[model samples]
Target: MPRALLLTLAALLSACSPRVLSAEGWSFRIGDAAGEVRLVSRQEFGVCSPKLVGCTVPLGHGCLVMLDRDYFLNGTPRQRTLLLAHEVGHCLDASVLEYGHGGIGAQGAVYGEYYRPAVEGFAESYARAYVAVCGDNLAPLGYGSGPACALPDPRTVRVSLP
Candidate 1:
């Protein structure tokens, strides 16, 4: 396409894009909010060893966010979903923080042979809690940090997914 036409199309798309506020300092599109839990691409993972397939942010920019690889070539859907939710659990562990890259690296234990189970436990708990709530209707959210699976029992305060 000609430069002028490309520029015009870009401007049109930008104008058509939804404008959302920075809720709690992070904002996403309507599609992201539509799902009970947001499933983001692995490119979003942005940290940790390559061998590690999933992650959740417990603090800083991505706190409470969970992500897995784009597809489960090396994992099952259930496993990937649980992994992503677990990462979100880490983010929800405490109030989100604004740690720099070095601080986040230290917290995530990227540099050491840390007891990963201790950290992974949170993700696991979150996944279990989520699954217990949403049950089978959560197929569209795919395998990642989903709120559907973590719904509180009817007697609890957890909100129902849309």
Candidate 2:
């Protein structure tokens, strides 16, 4: 999709509510920190399956975000931030490296070496990489040292703002 269209969608998503803004901020920051590859939200990811979480589709263009109302409202800010970052990691996986063209079968495997484990492994690796460089000091945002807060390379994941 065109960058302009993507930005427009992001703006529309952000305008949905305050939660969207917060989520967008997290996505933007993380994307910028990681360097290269753009991250944005879509209205719907086009696939709804049990295997994928947080609007993850195996088509692999980017992640489609859906902030659960309960989590956004009741969960701590740190929790929300981590969740957003995690989902964004999945987006990065789709758009950049593993842009799988296969549908549900290729996307969601029931029994194979290339299914759940590989997908989660890649996502976790990306998250860990981000944390390692960025540090877990999201304290200013009222977040504490969660799993993502203790990264080792707090410098590599910095994304440049446009």
Best by lDDT: 2
TM-score of each: 0.41, 0.43
**Tens-place lDDT digits, model 1, residues 64-119:** 34243344435665665455444444444432222122122222332234423434
Q: Name the top TM-score candidate.
A: 2
- The sequence of per-residue lDDT tens digits that candidate 2 reaches over residues 14-124 is 454333434533323233222112222333222333233344332224333554544544656545555545555555556654533111223223333433454544444
- Residue ranges of candidate 1 with Cα displaced over 4 Å: 1-44, 60-66, 72-77, 96-116, 136-162
Q: Estimate the TM-score for candidate 1.
A: 0.41
Separate clash counts for every candidate:
10, 14
RMSD of each: 12.1, 9.7
Q: State the displacement of the C-alpha of residue 153, model 1, in Å, after optimal TM-score superposition.
A: 9.3
